[model samples]
Target: MVFYIIGAIILVGVIAYVAVNHIPKKLHWILSIILLATAGYLLFLINNSIMEPLRFNTEKQIRYTEVIKKLKVIRDAQVAHKTVTGDYTKSGEDLIKFIDTAEFAITQTRNVLVKQKRGLITVDIEKRVVDTIGHEPVRAMFAGKDYKNMLKIASNNNIKFIFSVDEIQKFGNLTEPVFEVKVDKKIVLTGLTDYLIRQELEAATGDEVRGEFISVGSLNEVSENGNWPPYYDKADKNLNKK
Candidate 1:
């Protein structure tokens, strides 16, 4: 928009100057051709300046959508693993295999009378006992979803997601299991304009996908949510609505 305004001002100034100076008739066509070329160049700049960012944003959303979908799949699979094994798995192949062949142990809990030792005293106490009654296939929970490629990044095949697991202290007493699966923004935004990618990297707000990674879960915390803005999820829902 600014470029259009500036171009218009410069063009008007050139035309006024030419008419005031009264250039030769032979030179009039030359000036006209030059003006026409200048106008065409300005239009090109206007188009490019307006369209380049749009193009960048469009591609960014496309890549982010696919990446978020895969990240969600990974997160669910990890959650299922933790439910069954009491901890998250770091290996993608192991997670897939577990999902394919493992069964969830369905159990029932009942109160039973048992002897408990407390402070050198033995007393009869009612305790809860859980018994496995049946089994449900783990694969059944992941029906119609893709887990085999949960480790692979959908946007860029050259770089897969990097995941790790650890234990963190919560409330300075409880040790909780933690995991994080992440990919560098550069890898996800590969082939994009360097300056724009740098801008995104430097961003530090929730308004955009700010930071060095487009990741889910956390090694420092126990969250299973992605770091992207809510609009990404809304965008996915909107696309599905269509």
Candidate 2:
């Protein structure tokens, strides 16, 4: 609508200029050129302001599709494991632990292993060094207990509290007092998983990973772009792929 209005205004101005020039025969050619240029500049402004974000959204959609594809691959692998084990049941954390072990193996060879991460609020308990880092939401083992102070007190006692991913799996309840451990080098450990868990967080959350898609995207993008592309693969042309 605005574009049409602007174009109509320019057309009116041009017609007026022509009529006045014929009557007065005094209008300069430079003034006509200036008016034409001003109209063109307005069009350029509209394109940059209105059209660029649309382009950006197109790029975002493409990147999101790729994320979903990779996530599906990871999910298929997890389903395969469950099929073999005859356990159609496992909590999100157990699946992550399984993948964590596998990720560890891949890193030993210094290979690029992609995984998805999802944030969930859970209590972590170990020997008492419970601080939550990574994408997971951290909370206190006891409802009335202050998790921060608990961790601080535990650390002072030289007790290493393990983040309670394991206990949560066993007890089948996040409400059970679980110790949170800040896994060192989360970037590294997150990618590592045992043989039992094939694809790290990808298997753990599946599409639920959608919640933290932005953060996972940020980390992966940084890693892929900040470092050289994989030796066997081409560099990603999509700037938003991370």
The prediction achieving the highest TM-score against the true structure is: 1
Off by over 4 Å in 2: 1-27, 82-242
TM-score against truth, every candidate: 0.81, 0.29
Please list the C-alpha lDDT of all candidates, in the order they appear. Answer: 0.84, 0.35
Name the lDDT of candidate 1: 0.84
C-alpha displacement of 79 in model 1, angstroms?
Answer: 1.1
Taking the tens digit of each residue's C-alpha lDDT, what string does model 2 give over 1-242?
36665775777587667657664545655556666776777677677657655654454334334333333323332443343343322333444444433221111122343443446644433332333233311121122323223223221233222222222233355322122122122222232223212232243343322221222111111111111113212323353276
Q: Which candidate is the best by lDDT?
A: 1
Candidate 1 lDDT score at position 37: 76
